[model samples]
Target: MYQSSTIINHIANFTSQRNTELLAFSLLKSVNSMISCLSTKIITVNKKGEVRDHLFFENNHCTVKDNSIEIDNVLRRSFEHMHDSSLAALTLKTKAGYSVIRLLHHDRKSEQFLIINLNEKMTKENDYILSGILSIYSNFIQLLNESQTDELTGLANRKTFDSAISSVFNTRPREHKEVDSERRSPNEIIVKENHKYWLVIIDIDDFKSVNDRFGHLYGDEILIHLAQIIRSNFRNEDLQFRFGGEEFVILLSADNQMECMQILERFRRNVEEYQFPNLDTVTVSIGVVELKKETFHITSIDYADQALYKSKKSGKNQITFFENMLSQGIAKKSDIQGGSVDFF
Candidate 1:
């Protein structure tokens, strides 16, 4: 029912999205519009086969949820035989009509799935049309990723972080950026009273010495290793960004102060114990602050940076909380300084 001009406009709109997640959402919405007879859903899964986010639409109802275990299990069983680059299509005789369901593997590492439920009967012409639409979606996704990802570490770059935080977390004042719920796991949901969104800045201790003693290549490897350890320590839903060089940032949600402390402490310990080849005693200093809806993103980063400064000043390989520093009168709001650490 849609014209060629309408489809081209949708493709243009999808390519303009700033991040991969947004692109994924836009792709589904555009497809749904161009093919009005189809129902669409976009689901993102992690390497562990867990659903991180899902968007489902049908009739006049729409549901967006953080994660669903039952849905994950069902999808896994349904598409267990398909591999990468393969499209699985099926026909179902539902009460509504003779519908078609298509499962598409969007990405391997992320396990993103593009599921479409079409209300029309299957036909050769419809299959060709669907294939063309998916091709456009795939091309746009690749372009978006290239612009947003860090080349070496495979994490998000600073540019991605700047846009992501503002777009994802800073929507409603005092409310955590609710887009996709930003949950760490599908099971972890934000409860108003019991949860806090924490912003953390991680810096490798004395990173200059590593680059100095060993060549830059080895230093680069150390940075890669550090990134791997960080990925292992944090949840997939958490937004992890490599600001530059040895510095990284994580926006995470925790149940409370103790849990927050535990998460950071565990990461600190993990980095302390990891033995990097050709490197001696690689460690990191962390600064953490609970992000509030009213606080500006830059200010939150400064607070976390100040906390990190305290850790580096006393000794590396430790975690410091901004609230604790404030309570102890160690640092004041006006005293926090950004750009003190040399991430380069």
Candidate 2:
């Protein structure tokens, strides 16, 4: 068994350059070869509903192909009747239309399937081989999921951000060219091109008032409600995160700064107007930073945060731009508290 660090180091080497599907196939093949007569395959249908081979494991002189309408039908059926985490049967046929193993997955995203032949003609060796291989495969898939999920908001955590950032940030193809210097670096791995991006950090207005007035449970309820509102209003391109108590972060793309700020302001307005249950009305303060590809994480996060502090200090429930707020004396730190400024 490879140490977790060793596996991570291997993965790190492959970062930005590796074909993740092939790497996943290699991991499956390792488990497959450990069990005789075991083979594995992963298939995914495209946006157009066309079935395609995503990953396949080779057995002693035998191969697995991913293309098949019959397999697609069974896979889709398995998805319908039982959850991806469920243990269930999916009757399927091979490329030549021969009846093959029934498959069950532990996850839908990775689309790993444990194959079994229900035909009585199967040997005990085949059953043992399949069982052992599946046990290992399922463990691997579970690990992948644990890495991607966020504990707080049930959203795609920062662990899932790398690929997402790349698809939207890395614009030019010359960067994709193979050169020792041009390789996918720790930062370069997620570059994409052709759109302005914004990273908006949000904090619920007067969140401590809830904990102080009601209770921690009520505070949590407000957080959950705030999460729901952000999720519903944001576009699919945006990724939402609970950075910690009362704070959420959103990454989104827009054509320009005007559009980005407008979207965030609208989100702010929605929060301001919406009636949260058990509360009169809730408000949020947002600090939006326009992101350039290389300048992803700027000290501007602090600037944005200072802007947010201004919103809270002057008044709650407002959107504050870092540059404008910082230029004036509005963002200065103070030992003073409870005193307030005019509302926007």
Candidate 3:
């Protein structure tokens, strides 16, 4: 009974190895069709531990080629159990003669291996050919990933921004190069879902003072904290940037000028309400504008800047939306007031 069970197990193992070798051979045949001249076979060891999947291509009247000199140094090392089946070109001292060997492991168990012996020689040219073929497509894939991020924030940077805002402003029919308006013009681009995008420029209020009082360490901590807030408040597609020192810019694709203004105001209110160590509260003033696709010039950036300046000039820790072109005029309160916008 014991001998019968062992024999059955051996047969099962042989069948499994043969099946795997057949699959490997089919795959290699497909590969061979693409290459100029190639021959492949899978020499899997059977349950008896002899070659299982057997296919040999040669002129008939063949005896197993057995000549130590003809089969020279190849496959100097046996495969280690720890590794998956791998690829290698091997030359071995065979009974027949020196032949080209490509070793492929069949299974994780290392229970099966494949050795393909070719009647021809494999020069160094063949070894490096496949790698060169692969790199052409790989490099472009790497570049595409780099385009979307600000090197600093790892956030959607400028070029990524160009693509994002184009969705709302419209990617086609682009013509405006100088028009600046109350809403989006030729320069500014806003992504409006139901409405157009609103651009917001946020500056850390009296950030220099924070730097002076607590040192750059604390200043950076504040900056990082504010960045976290920015990340949390916005969606993944909302573009944010560390535009410059103590300044950040964000584009929300879905909101209108009023909605954008309210959003910034809420951020200001949140900052004012939070207490910090060795600090009372920190506030940021923001400027907002709707990006106008038509008649929008690239100079919309400058308009957003002017509005940001107005917020700083009028009072710190407040939200100011761009009305229109500053030359045409950006809206301002009748008088520049002192003190803060009371926390809301």
Q: What is the C-alpha lDDT profile of model 1 across 37-77, one tens digit per residue?
A: 65777666666767777766655334456645447444565
TM-score, each model?
0.81, 0.62, 0.46
> Which portions of model 2 show Cα errors greater than 4 Å?
1-87, 95-130, 140-150, 156-192, 294-298, 323-344
Model 3: residues with Cα > 4 Å off, grouped in runs: 1-152, 158-168, 171-193, 275-277, 295-297, 324-344
Residues 171-266 of candidate 3 have per-residue lDDT tens digits of 332222211111222223333346566667788889999999889888877877788788877864476877656878787665455666666767
Whole-model lDDT for model 2 versus the true structure?
0.57
The digit string of per-residue lDDT tens for model 2 on 209-299 reads: 8899999988988887788788889964477767678888777777777888788888999898888878888899887766543443534
Which stretch of 10 consecutive residues in model 1 shows the poorest summed lDDT?
A: 181-190
What is residue 74's positional error in candidate 2, in angstroms?
6.4
CA deviation > 4 Å runs, candidate 1: 36-38, 44-50, 60-62, 71-77, 84-103, 106-110, 167-193, 335-344
Specify the poorest-scoring 10-residue window by lDDT in model 2. Answer: 174-183
Prediction-by-prediction clash tally: 0, 9, 26
lDDT score, candidate 1, position 341 = 37
Best-fitting candidate, measured by TM-score? 1
The stretch of ten residues in a row with the least summed lDDT in candidate 3 is: 60-69
